[model samples]
Target: MAPTRQMSRPEESTLDLGEFTLKYRGDALPQPELLVIGKRSGRHKAVHTFVNILDNDGNLVRQAAITPDIASFIFGSFEVRGSTEAFNIYESDLVVGKWSPRTRTNVSPDLVRHQRTIAEQSFTATGGKLAHHWPIFQKLKETGFGSIIRATLTLHQLCSSNCPFCSTILRNKRDSVSLTEAQAFVSTLYNEQAALNRNEFVRYNEEYRRLTGTDIRLKGLILSGGGQPNLWPHFSEFVRWLGELDLDVGLITNGFPPKIAEDVYERFKWVRLSITPESASPFYPDGRFDRQYIPASLRHNDSLTVGLSYVYGPWTDDDMLKRLDASAHENGFRYVRLLTDCNLTRQAQLKAHQDLADRLFRLGFIDEVGKPLSRIFHQLKYHGSQREAEELWSDGQCKLQSYNVFWDTTGHEENGYSHCYPCDSVTVLADEQGETDISVSERRFNADKWGTVKSTEVHRLFTEPLQPFFDPRDICASCLFMNNNRAVSDLVKRASYGDMNLDTSLEHLNFP
Candidate 1:
């Protein structure tokens, strides 16, 4: 609960890695002999386990297939003798061994490691950077009862897109939406939003309202389920309806139709178009329904404040991205944002993304032709480059924003961090089999504690009561990103460019 200041004696006790905090003595700590970091918590986590192998340098050397139970991990996994590499671990009610200590230590600056770290760094930086703009946590800390600035909103669990790059696709393991239930879920939220037994929704809304002296509006409205919401004919009606509600409207799509986008843009005006030439190779039929077609459509629509989101990574060719960035900018976007693989899944991909980011920052993070790579991390890295970057940060910890949340109709609720956001805390998920809702109880909505929040209510909060606090550039003064982004972006740039500050004020900060 204390300010996230570094512990001079961290090695003597607690070790904070910005995401997870644990007690370590530097010499020996409760190093679980085996670890199974899964996507979701509780019973939903897949049984992916690996032995805790460390070498003389305190570097993780290797991992064996000793599926040690959490019980042993909490007990003797670290204390066991005889060579952990060779020993078997008891899990699944019996002894198991995936590998032995004799296996060569997989030691190398592996690209896999690089990719994973960059992905994480990217996500955390974006979320935290944006959150720094709010007074939620600061206000809570100064309040009477524990004031937890709540970032909670329920996502409409109805999507049909089976994009390979989507974590949802990996979870649902399908190429299409589950018909029977998916449609019904949509049916429920519409006439259903105001119909829910107001008991729960009202209680929560009022509680936070009294505490913060304001209502928690839904954050951002994402019409996407797993499939494209625009794919549905009524999708326009939905976008138009939400836009009329006086909230910031956003939808992430594969850009199948520019008309759909124009329709939404006409109503919401704030739209995000995410495309992956990597997955949709050749960039046409499989890409944005034909890149030229989409761009042509955008070239004429001057009303859009578009967010160009590319499914780009380290391996993404410079030429490809250059063209991509140029095309998006030419089409009239306010800014471009890359959907980097910050989940640390691919090392090659991660570094390549960072490299592109580096190039951007070295040149003031604007492209060689003088276009703003506003979403690039070299700018973020530049943020961290200040010599006193550490001193200014509270915990000096890295994070992947808060969490990823979507909403169609689940009134107001928050699903904590996941692939798109923070690394830990309460999580809402449908089972691997796509059966039920599995989550950590008492959802932790504290953005400061989790480093991010993915909730529909969040978008609303910003545009509403706190709308007065909203400043694209000036907002930087009170933003959480200032603490982290300024240092990180500065550090990255200084490493490549030099120490300098260009007005990133909202107005000076370019928008398409």
Candidate 2:
């Protein structure tokens, strides 16, 4: 039997107001950046006061109000205890900004009633799956592109591996960018000004301002490739330079020992290694399981998280999965991600993952009730197949495209200026007539091909109005970030009347 894990209760603080006494537990609910207030009218009736949003430093940023319906969504329904009409209020129930660390009370600019911002109030209203990206929703209200909080830098488009399912491998033609160019790109992103003049910054900055009138900067970067990034010549130098920026960096690569410096590799916040079926052959050949198939550097270290991704198809047998699971456990990998081959038919894709779940259950990796036991496998249950013909989304908006920037080798740099794609799925290429050509594929076309970036000056990209050329309903057959799209759309719909609604405060934990 497994030992039961214990959870520590959060410390409590109390506030007395003669008629009603409020008790707050910081950890009882989702963490809140804004304060909330709950007033009791009678024994069971609750009255809530709505007001302007305040920052932690006791400054007014924006005006916001909470209706009764909005208040209930933010604080949740109240529960009465004993005979005294005292309410055990969660931190989320208050109508103020973040509490002062010095004083446990809600930090209000003036009064407790006018504490939380409209964005804070509205963010908690819709507890959707994309709640983590509530920050993006606020920016998306203006343009599809203003909410971008992360960037994917695809440095090269070359791979020697003979993977059968690779779509980008066929397009491997561009040479890796020089180390000088890569370093310059990183520096430009870090500095915030490369091509934009003061006038351009002001013109574009309005679209990206948070509800609190603060500017949102790019928080994370993905070091990936159209092919294997490990094969890039400047991989080591670029990574070492990125370490200087101290930004949350993630790496996606085929499971090969990266020939980079150990300190540089450890700087990555996460490393998602794809251990293909071909890579698994050496581990389980002739019913022999070799633990050394996984490199020591790729295992969970004290600094960074390591995980494995496997594409399941007709080639995947029960034995192969067992070997993969065993290796993940022994290698200290966080989780094993099992995904169906997108090349397969929609029905086949669904069945492939379903069968994987069933097999794992039978093999005792998971219980009969579908709860994990020995292994944690994130089966792509919500995954939409690339072959799906029907539209997975009905909405015309693809706001997620505006929220992230995916730059690849297809994008070009000239005269200290850069023209790039919006997401990995979209690219801008010079046409036969010397005009820009936006390449559209089931995957590629889902993300819009917007404008250019001056050097790595991404400020213009965030501030510019992202006018999508195609509606997602018309072009996007399936998307991996559908939950994010749904969340952004829901938030935009709720905030249509200039009122913001979102979930618990993520404290700027924004990423793609």
Score every model by TM-score: 0.42, 0.59
At residue 472, what lDDT does model 1 achieve? 20
Residue 208: error of model 1 in Å?
12
Task: Output the lDDT of residue 289, model 2.
Answer: 38
lDDT of 2 by residue, 231-250 (tens): 77878777777887757788
Point out the worst 10-residue segment of candidate 1 by lDDT: 429-438
Best by lDDT: 2
Q: What lDDT is obtained when candidate 2 is compared to the true structure?
A: 0.46
Model 1 per-residue lDDT tens digits across residues 239-325: 555665534444556555555654445664445566554322333543332254554434546665555666543224456556555
Evaluate model 1: give its TM-score: 0.42
The count of backbone overlaps in candidate 2 is: 21
Question: What's the true lDDT of residue 100 in model 2?
Answer: 19
